[model samples]
Target: MTASPEIQEIAIVTGASTGIGAATARELARQGFHVLAGVRRDVDAEAIRATGIEPLILDITNPEHIQALATRVQGDSQGRAVRALVNNAAIQANVPIEAFALDQWRAMFEVNLFGQVAVTQTLLPALIASRGRIINISSVGGKVAMAAYGPYAATKFAFEAVSDSLRRELSPHGVHVIVIEPGAVRTAMLGRAIATAGELVSAMTPEQRQRYGALVHAVNEQAISSTKSGVPAQAAATVIAKAIAARKPRTRYTVGREAALLTMVRFLPDRVLDRVLAAALRPHYPKLPSVYDA
Candidate 1:
C-alpha cells in the first residue's frame, strides 16, 4: 500500500529505541511515509530523530503515553492518514518456568503482550479509518518453546494467538493484521536476555539450581551462537517494509531462514519435536556435571 502522492501518510513504530524496531522506523521513513518512532528514552529519541522520522516518547504500558499518541494520530496537523501501526515493542528473558518468579512473569507479559494490546487498541480507530495495516513483531519462540524459555515463549505464544484473533476480527473493517516472526537477529536484546537469565539463575534455590543450571547455561550459549550467525536488523526491517508496501500482504512473514524453518518444523509430532530441540541444544551444553547427564 504505497502512500498517495498528495496525502502525507503516517506509519507508527513502537520500541524504536534499538534493533528491529529502530531499523523498521528508518526503513518506513525512507519509503515516503511520515514515521512516528516510539522510544522510551530521551537519548533514543534524539538518536532517531531525522527526516521523515519523528520520535515520540511512548511507553506502551503507560495510559497517558498511549493516549497522547492516539491524540497525535487522530488530530494530525497535516491531516495525514495513518497507513500502518507496527506493534514492535517487546522484552525477553530466558528462564525456567519454576525459577522465574510469578511477578517476573507478570512484568514480562505486561510489556510484551499487554503493552502491545494497549497500543493497538488505542490506535485501532485511526487504523480502521485509514484502512491501515497492523504489523505485529513476534518471534520464533512463539512457535516452539525450548528449555529455560518457558516464560518468554508463553507471552509470544499468546501474542501469536492474539494476532490471529485480531486479524480475523478486523479483516472486514479493511484493516490488515500481519505478524512478522523473526529469528535471532544480531541485537542488544540477546545480551540483555542472557544477563537476565544469569540473575534468575542466581536467585534459584539450591535444588532448582542443580536441576536447571546446565540447561540455562546451554540455552544462553545457544542464544549467543545463534545471534552471532543471525541476520542484521536491517534485513528484518526490509521484510517489514515490503509487507507494509505490498498490495496484498501475507497474513504472516518470517524475517530469517531460521524463523521460516522453525515455524514449519513446529507442526511435527510433540515428542519428535522435543527430541529435535533437545538435540539442537545439546551441542551448546557446557562440559560440567548436571541433571541432563544422568
Candidate 2:
C-alpha cells in the first residue's frame, strides 16, 4: 500500500528527552510534521506527548530499543514513509586524553557515535522511501579539537566524516544528509559534563591526579562559566527546521555565530592552529618545576 505524500511527512527525533532534541521535536511539530519523539524515560515520553507530539520510548545505544523503535515506527507509519531523521543523541567525556581510560572512550562512542549510526541505519529504509533528510547534531568540536576535549571532539570529527560519506552516497538516491555543528548552546548537558568531570577526577589514581588535576579543574570551571552565556537550545532547533524545509540545504551548518567562527579554524594550517591552541590552554596547563625551583 503506497502512502500519500502527505502521509509520509513524518519526522523522527532521537534524544527528545531534553535539550536541542526536545526543542527540535517541538519545532517540527509546530511546522506541521508528524513528529515521533524518541525518549529514554517514561516520564519524558509522557511530557513530550502532552505537547501533542508522539513520544516513543527509545535508547539509541540499546540494540533492543533500536530494533523496537524500528518496528514501532514501521507499523505506526501505516504504510507511510518516514520523512526526516534527526540524529541528535550524544554524550560527552571531558577529561584529558592522557587520563582517559579505554572504557571511558568506549562509553562516549557507545552513545555519541555508535548510537547515532545505529539509529540512522535502522531507519534508513523509511527515509529512502520518502526521499527524506538526515539531520546530525554535531558540535563545533567537530572542526577544532580543544585540549581536554579531545576525546569528545574525536567523536564529532568521526561524525563529520560519517555525514560526509553518507551525504555523497545518498545524494543520487534523493536523500539529503545535513550536519548541524553548534557551539555552546545552553543545556543540562553542560552541568552534567561538569559533574562528570569531577567524577573522572575523583576516579583518577594519585599519579593521574598529579599529571592532570590542574587542567581538569580549569577546564570544568571554564565549561560552567561558558554555559552561562550560551545560546538557547531553541535557537539550534530553529536552524534544524530551516534545514529540513530548505530546497537545497547545505551539507554542513554551524548553528551559532561562535560555531561559524570556530569552523573557520579549519582554514588555518595545523602548525598555526597548534600555536593558537597552545596559547589558549597554556594558562590552564600545569607548570613544570625547573632545576632552579625550590
Candidate 3:
C-alpha cells in the first residue's frame, strides 16, 4: 500500500545536517526517495547539497519554520506523496533535575517532543495519502532513566508515550509509526558533551557546584567512555532505512548493543533493577547538601 515512485516518493528528514539524521538522509536517497533534508544553517545545507539530498532550512523548535517547511514541502509535493517522515531533530541537556532550569526543560521538550508533534500533525494528510511511515529517533536512555540524565530522559520518555499514541491513531489509516532507539551513537553531539562537561559544572552556583562536582565528573567520564565505545550513526541509519522500506514493521526497533541490553533490562523487577542501578552509579555519588551538612 506504499506510495509508488511514479508519484515522486518524497521523504522529509529533520535535523539532517549531521549524525543519524544526515546518515538517514543519505540512506533514504540511496533507496530512491527524493530526500528533503532539513538543516538549520545554510553552511550545513551546502555541505549536504553535494550528496543529492535537498537541504531545507528548518528549525523544528520554531513554529514559523515548521509551518514554512510544511507549506514548502506541500508545494514541492505537487506530483508526489510524502512517503516517509524521519523525526530526527532533538536536543540534550545533561544536568540533573535539581540543577536544571525550567526554561531548559521547556526548551528541550520544545525541540525533542512538541516540535515533532507539530511536524507530524501538519504532514498527517500526506502520510495518510501515501500510506507512509513515521520514524522517531529516540535513545537507549528512553528505555530507562539514569543518574544525572533526567532532563534528556524526561523528553525521550515522553517521546515514547507520544509515539505509542500516534502509532495507534495512525495504524487504522494505513500510516505506520515506528520508534528507533539508539544507544551512545558517536556524533558531534556526543563530542561536544564530552568536551564541554566542564561548562556544565561551571554554570552551577557555588553550592550547586559542590553538590554536583564528583557526580558530574563521573557522569561525563562514563559518557565519554560510552561514546568511544558507541555504535556508528550509519548503523542506526541503516536500521531506519530498513524500517521505512518494511511492509510490516515492528512498533519499536531498538538499535545498537547497548539498546538491546537496555531492552532486556526492562524486564527486571523494579526492586532488583533499582538495586542494580544504584550500585552502578554508586561510584559517581557526590556529597549532597542536606540539613545536617548545613
Per-residue error for 69 in candidate 2, Å, reads 1.4
lDDT of 3 by residue, 136-179 (tens): 99888788887778888988999999999999998899998999
Q: Tens digits of per-residue lDDT for model 2 on 1-294? A: 212346546789998989999999998887777788999899999878854379988888899989998987788735656778999988886888877888989989888899999999999988888899999999998989877899999999999999999999999999999999998799988878877877887877777777777777667656666667778999999999899888899988887777888789768999999897677655644366421111
Estimate the TM-score of every prediction: 0.96, 0.91, 0.91
Model 1 TM-score?
0.96
State the C-alpha lDDT per candidate.
Answer: 0.91, 0.84, 0.82
Judged by whole-model lDDT over C-alpha atoms, candidate 3 comes out at 0.82
Task: Report the backbone clash tally of model 3.
Answer: 0
Task: Give the runs in model 1 whose Cα sits over 4 Å from its true position.
Answer: 289-294
Give per-residue CA lDDT, model 1, range 204-255, as digits (tens).
8888888888888899889999899999999999999999889999999998
Which candidate achieves the best lDDT against the true structure? 1
Better of 1 and 3 by lDDT: 1
Q: Which candidate has the top score in TM-score?
A: 1
Residue pairs in candidate 3 whose N, alpha carbon or C atoms collide under 3 angstroms? none
